[model samples]
Target: MKTMRIWFGCSMGLAVSMIFGWSYGFFAALLPMFVLVQADRWSTPLHVQLVLEIVWVTVQVSLLVGFFQPYPLLMTTAVAIMMLFKCVAMQHKSTYLFGFTGLLIGSILLNFASYNFFDIEEFSINLWMCGLATAPITALAYFLFPEPECATPQPVTVNNEVTKDEYGMVRQAAMGWTVAMIAYLVFNLVI
Candidate 1:
């Protein structure tokens, strides 16, 4: 049942994205899949919140890139700090929404800014559209593949709890941030 929901949600998102010819449509696909798999309950307000999260991270990256364009050292330092915070927050599961948005979506926007692409605004708009569409795709998935009533429902997110896996979580976050840094370097060097 979970697998079916994921497949249906992702396929629907991808189909809509493809139909619209959105270059950043993979975002649309990915968000719905994640929501379907992770969240037991999703609401209309969640969609709005997700969109706002994307926009907020977009603004943060844009500001960082805009102000620090001339100073590689300053830009890198600031971004690195921000990403480190995001990584830690994500690992801690404290403010998962912000951490997830800031780490993943923010990094994408930062990469785009680094590339100095002429059509970046277009791409950002496409990304925003994808975010907006994610809620519906997830909602539709729920409608089409409702969970069996016999199964206990999980909350949307787990409360932050102390676990023995701190080292593993930190390692994962470090790995993620390292990849983001490498991608940033490649974009800067390539452009």
Candidate 2:
């Protein structure tokens, strides 16, 4: 029920971003859409969802990065990494954090390699911008779907009452998002 509204908001944001030439915005929105679709009670099977997610993401990336002379192998690897991270992130606790960390490491390696191998300055900047955009988009999505524990309070009382584990995790993730955004900004300024 509530998921639909979140998905719509994400979709609309992505559309607006694309229209305004912010490719990263479109990719950022996909995170929420994938989350919303995964949360759907009547959602399609896992295989179907994976197929659609991959196809749509691939299409989006191809269109967004089409202007650049992307290296085929690197592009493939990047998309593969994104798909894997998205799949894992759609699951239970700590998945997003782990998946994103992996994606970031892979991207840093790839982008650094691209810069050295191809002498392209824009790839690093684009990667940083992607991180900046992803931080907010992910934080917003987490705020909307949130973990069940954080989103609801248990009636059971423990010294009055203690919130669920999801609350702690979600709060930590929210805080991390701010750090990530700040780090991205600082790095962008420095680099």
Candidate 3:
């Protein structure tokens, strides 16, 4: 059942995205497969949650870009500071998903906003559309392949090593962001 849902949602989403050639349409593929795997039930508010997440990130990126577009130095600094905050917040115990989504979408949009022709409004609308596209696909995936009834529900484990987990996540997030920023700088220099 899980396999069917993943395969159907991902493949169908990829197909639809490719066919329509939407700028931010990859969300259609990613969200459905991701939510399909993460959701325990079909009727969860996955679609709404995803939209809100995307919208929040979009607003963040748009405002930063809009305010700093004329000054490249300020733009870079603002983007770096925001990314650092997102990276650190993403590793925190309580706000992982929200920060992670912001980091993912904000990084991409920020990079694109470097170009003058980039359209924030269009991207935001298309992003919402891509999110909306997930609802029906997820519903279909759930309807077609419902979770099997298991006699025993698996036990959920709580991690007691809060400091260890948070430290490791912070270290990893910093390393990742550092490497990404350096690479972006080097690539820009080369290009």
Report the C-alpha lDDT of model 3 over 1-191, residue by residue, as the tens digit: 88899999988888788888887787778878767766757755556766678888888888987898688678778877877877777665455555666777777777676666878888888877777788888888888888888799878888777375666877888886786577545544453
**Candidate 2 residues 1-191, lDDT tens each?**
45644665476557656765653454446444544444433233432433343344434443424543256555554445454544346334434433453344333433333333442234334334443444355445555655454456657755854445776656655554444444433443454
**What are the models' TM-scores?**
0.81, 0.32, 0.78
lDDT of 3 at 112: 73
Model 1 misplacement above 4 A: 43-49, 151-162, 165-175
Residue 166 alpha-carbon offset, candidate 3, angstroms: 3.6
lDDT score at residue 79, model 3, on the 0-100 scale? 74
Residue 156 CA displacement from its true place in model 1, Å: 19
Ranking by TM-score: 1, 3, 2
Total backbone collisions, model 2: 0
State the C-alpha lDDT per candidate: 0.78, 0.45, 0.75
TM-score of 1: 0.81
